[model samples]
Target: MNDDLHLRIILISPPADVDFGLQSGSGNKYKTVQKQVSGNGDLLFVLSVKIKNDKDGNIDFAGPFVQGSKGERFIYIDIGTYAGNPESEWGRRLKIPLRDIPVSVIEKLQPDNKLILETRVPGMGKDGGPNCATVKPFEGWHAVPV
Candidate 1:
């Protein structure tokens, strides 16, 4: 069994031609490509992460992963300003914390298991301000067999 965690992070109907990526707590990053979504939109990314555990038995990862203190462990996602250029002044960074996740879901996490995280990027353009991009979980998080 592959102990590494498989993450399927999907962005539904993001702003056209914008860039997106996955960022770790160590500052490493992976840029996402615009892939065709079934609904005439784009899917941001589906990344694989190596699972690590802290001394306190909390879940952690090796690279480009961030887990908060005992109360707020999370995964970080970055939204770039443009499709090709990730360094735009208008880019945004979002987080998906592990809080509120059911214990049953965590218990189901085994080697090679896949976790699906779907979110929608809201208020991209328009009067939405510089920090306008707010990420909300679209369908919540799911853990499934690989």
Candidate 2:
């Protein structure tokens, strides 16, 4: 495995003003992106390698992250549904763990590469399932040519 492999998680136009962050393996928290918003009216979360999965595949990530604890890796997506509505009240700030993403999808990523993602929040679909945020590599999603 390459030591510099990284994946960028970009949310394409979320439905609400949401905040995102990261919790490291040491139980330290860091505010990554405030009110996830891309210039094109979307949210972007760049994936960085915090710790390499050992033989145990213990994920040292927590708090709104998608990482695998097993041998496989994952991408975590956490969204804050501060819409102040009933449906949005219960599942507010859902911790979505994308455990099914194939490692090959991002295994070849280099420092300059990016993995564009598309998701359906508060709905059931690809990447994640019902009543949770879903994220999947955009069809034909590949490492950006460097």
Candidate 3:
């Protein structure tokens, strides 16, 4: 392949309540993972899903490939963290780099599709506690509000 593909996978858009004004990667958390697919069917996984902030978090990923028998294919990404609330700022925005994802996976995600976003907060059950938020992005990415 002469050129590489790039995509901004969006997990969530920021709510109106956030004060995410003029910040770097100001909208959504994203990880820039990439794969270079050769015409001969070679694939390379470049990176893993990462958080947008300084905190430590982790995620998992599976193929940007085709399922031959069933004719079903998709990229699998799972992210979970104690998504802290956005008081002065937001925390733990996650991202999936489009270039890292195969076009096969991108085809599966369309607008208005309801997908599950797994989450846990340090104190979601209590009052005066921090809440979590959404993540998305492009190249030169940063974890920002969705």
Angstrom error at residue 57, model 2: 12
Q: Which of the numbered candidates is closest to the native, going by highest lDDT?
A: 1
The clash count of every prediction, one per candidate, is 3, 4, 15
Error of 3 at 23 (Å): 10
Please, what are the lDDT tens digits per residue for candidate 2 over residues 8-119? 4445444443343332222234233333421335555555454344556532332234345553444444334332222332233333344444556555553444444233
- Model 1 CA deviation exceeding 4 Å by range: 1-3, 26-40, 49-63, 81-89, 111-134, 137-139
Tell me model 3's lDDT, rounded to 2 decimals.
0.25
lDDT of each: 0.49, 0.39, 0.25
lDDT (Cα, tens digit) per residue for candidate 1, span 57-112: 66554434544555555665555552235365445655655455454665576554
Worst 10 residues of 2 by lDDT: 23-32
lDDT of candidate 3 over 74-109, digit per residue (tens):
222221221222243333322222233333343333
Q: Clashing pairs in model 1? A: 24-64, 24-65, 25-65
Give the higher-TM-score candidate: 1 or 2: 1
Residue 125's lDDT in candidate 3: 11
